[model samples]
Target: MATTTASVMGPHQKYAFEDTTSLLKDINRLPLFMTELDPTDGEGGSNLALEALQALAYEGTPFEIASNFKQQGNDCFSLKHFKDAAEYYGRAIAAILQNDKKKEETSGENSTDKAELAETDEHGSPLQIIDNCGPNADDDEAEKLKELVTTCYLNRAACNLELKNHRRVINDCAEVLKVQPRNAKAYYRSARACLAIDKIKEAQECVERGLDLEPQNSYFKNLAIKIMQREDYLLKVQQQNTQREFMRKHVVRI
Candidate 1:
């Protein structure tokens, strides 16, 4: 004959129970998600967890992802892990290019403006102009992305230099020059890479450009002297070779 006692669970307890149930459901699905993200070949739980963390970290705006990779590249460079640093830098560059493509796709109407801005002076233009932003444009985000791309290229060039990847270094430096021709470091790095591969004339051009940008840079001055000496050495070797060829062709045999 007595009424049943009301259930003692509070609203908060009910919500907590629902949350726990939802979490359990998610946990059940996690293995499938992980497999899709990174199919493992019998890797341990720790490795799986690390892969999951990396996948999460990669979820962000393109610029954010690029910045993260660029920082990782800088850390590796500081540790003298040139190969790893170069890989990270390459990833950063890819992310930046992806961002650029997205912007171009979404803002096709602005293509004319971008083309006009791309016509700025190679050595004297401001970053805004180089980035296809008008000098008066107030788009801080575009400027930042441009700067990040430039830095990534420059840093990758440094990593290539350390790895003795002279051609890659020159290519990376050339990319930076395309965006920021006044970047003395880019010029210097290009010069160094050119000299490494015996591109004496190219090296001299880079050195001169760098000197134009940074007249007081002792590194550029020293590099200029080295390029000149290399040119002289090559000339002497060519002359000697020519003389030997002439003797071989014209001298009488005993």
Candidate 2:
């Protein structure tokens, strides 16, 4: 008895299939298909590129998009559009926050996977020989994100200062300082906001902190001078008022 393979095609049989390249060409002909995209033309193209970037922002990894938003915020700030700049910086901060959450989730998943691998094969595990005790990809990403977040906060603080939103300036500067304790711009911006709202002592403290961070910063030096002058003027005014009150109360028979 002769046995034959059951899954074989006969000699006269041929598989019916369309050409993949032709199919691809046909698909590309569709109006909605964007086979070719140019991102450097005419204010960065029309809605197509904009919509694509927006989709990427929603779907892609957060760092690049967040950085892009930061650059946009800087551009608006250069043009002195404080409110618009603040909005852009706010978007960058939101993206970074989302990115941090995603990283935490991924780290948790990786840790669980590592644990399960260890349990399943204690000797054969690759991690046994080469332990990665040093900084990892996630750690680098986290540091980069921290820098970006600090920059965004500082820029937002500048915008808030320009808008006369003193409380918001203080808040943003404080946020920056949380990530970058020696940031002179954060201290200076916070101090400026404090001075704006008549928190003289707080403003002085911020100035001193900034000066300690960057003693040669001309802006901080100028601000320190301004604060001192303002304080002197305030003291002079107080003394004049006190003298006027004394004369009024101790008036003799004149």
Candidate 3:
């Protein structure tokens, strides 16, 4: 029996000779898909293609979306667009928080009472049970997201500082400190904002904490000096007021 091979079509044979030029023309029109096409024009496609592309660019996992927004915030900050940068950082924070809520809900659903009754030793004392369950995959992911959220808060604080939103800067830095108590930048920023608003005590506390974390940091050192100077000035003003009050109260009648 004789076997015959199947004839495969080559590139040139795939289309009719005259139709090849028309196909090339269609290929050349591909760029037009991205542009907003006029509805009255002969083109059948709408701007949906462009919209879809834009949506696709934004679609990602929560961490990825947060990271993208963070990068956008960094770009805006570099350009000194502090207000826009803060907005982007806020978006990043919202994205991460949304993911955290979802994770919490899922964990609630899958959680069980894994705790057991404690066992007693030979002497009737409760035995010390050390949990060897080290950090799991979920723990690792949570830690990463926490770090990202802290970074977003810190960046937003920086933007707020440039915008002179002292309270907002303090709040953002407080959020960072809550998550990362040893964060020197958060303490520094918070101290700066408190000092800006004349919250001398608060500023002094933040400066002390930051200095404890970074004793050699020039920024913290300088801020500490400023806080001390402000405190002394306020103390002098209070004393002067007190003296004036005493003199007014003891003034002889004319």
Candidate 4:
């Protein structure tokens, strides 16, 4: 399937049409269904396109509005709005990834966290952390923030998946679980990473934990079944390989 790769430049440039033609070209690297998407004056999409969408989003565009609300809701996780912080973090990472966010990282992993930040938490210090989603809030804004923690992690995990950083994805899922232990998506991601690294037993364990946390989650249930099947298949393969090797080595010199 075609994927949305990050621009060599930043999201600001990307959103500002600094290289519209190239962006469009990259967008069209493979076949797409943008047939229904129209550009103003038939000029094709540009920074104007993004701004227009942002404007519509602000002006009651249901989907955009929902996203905005969700973002706002993401702000309620902590009394300090850790979810909002995570969204900002996601945006920052995306920006640096696209080159729009340019804060220096604590250690420059992706220039995510600035070299100097005074942010401290329950852990007694600040760390370059990201999350998938957060808990629920009674207020609208807080609810939005609470809902984003799990999703934010899933979104970031996707980026890691694209980069083939399966191990990092596993760690990201771990962070997701810290916020909400019942996060099925996080477990799915961790299992996927385990499978990628040939840790079938580990993947099975993660899936099982996920299912136990949410017995009704179809995703987790399906994943658990799939992991068991894979584990069995892997075992069969190893056994077959062993038998073949033994046969070859021990066959009488006939």
With a 3 Å backbone cut-off (N, CA, C), the pairs that clash in candidate 1 are none
Give the whole-model CA lDDT for all candidates, comma-separated: 0.70, 0.68, 0.67, 0.53
By descending TM-score, how would the candidates be arranged?
Answer: 1, 3, 2, 4
TM-score of each: 0.68, 0.61, 0.63, 0.47
Model 4: per-residue lDDT, tens digit, 1-254? 99998868647644476477656645543223232233333345354544355344334322233355345434433334443444443542232122112323233242223211212233211112222122332355434443443465565565566556787688667766776787777888888889777798889888888778787878877777777787888899999999999999999985
The number of clashing residue pairs in each candidate reads 0, 0, 0, 19
Task: Kindly report which residue pairs in candidate 3 clash with one another.
Answer: none
Candidate 3, 1-254: lDDT as tens digits = 99999998766653456476555644444435412223321256544544454345346766787788889799889989898778777776665444422244233221011001111122111111111112343656666677776788789899989899999888777666765789999999999999999999899999898888888999989888888998999899999999999999999979
lDDT winner between candidates 1 and 4? 1
On lDDT, the leading prediction is 1
Give the C-alpha lDDT of model 2: 0.68
**Stretches of candidate 2 above 4 Å error?**
1-56, 100-137, 244-254
Candidate whose TM-score is highest: 1
